[model samples]
Target: MGGEWFEVLRPPYLPVEIRWERAVADGLPADVSHAFGIFDTTLCGVQEAGMSPSDHWWLPERESACDACREAAGVIDDRRPRAMRGEDARVSVARRL
Candidate 1:
């Protein structure tokens, strides 16, 4: 129920599930996942803390929880890190000095 918004944001070639996996595989930009996670957590509370959508917003389909996970996730502050210069960071083989 909470992922309704996500249903519309379909990317061509990659299905939603695959895209999510790709994001994980490619190491998605932290800010993008972090912020979105916060919003999503707010809608569907965490289980470890005994929180669920029914706890506050009345999700209609799920049971109540102790507290929402979004609260724990906190708000997003988008200040992306800058790219490193000089060398290719991912080069596995060490270069000869």
Candidate 2:
């Protein structure tokens, strides 16, 4: 959970989600090699040169939170479990009852 996702502030205080690996590989500082790291694109494919990483979480309720990034990260408000989808939904419900 900790390394799965990270957030960064884009222009106008837009908070976007980024994958941990991509961030580290692309320029997120993890050690000496990434000391001068700088991330460019977000999970939602928004590219902005020289984006810095933030230690904050992606609060979806925030006014500046990026919706596209939220959707790309599968951070939606859907209450249904991942297993409860399509034909499996009926089967799951029957088992629960």
Model 1 worst lDDT run, 10 consecutive residues: 16-25
lDDT score for candidate 1 against the true structure:
0.24
lDDT of 1 by residue, 1-97 (tens): 2234323321123212221210111332223221112222432231123212221232222232212323332221112112322232222344457
| Pairs of colliding residues, candidate 2 | 27-37
| lDDT to native, each model | 0.24, 0.39
lDDT of 2 by residue, 1-97 (tens): 1111233222221122332223223443333111112356665565545664455454444455555655655543244455443432332122332
lDDT of 1 at 5: 31
Candidate 2 Cα errors over 4 Å, as ranges: 1-39, 75-97
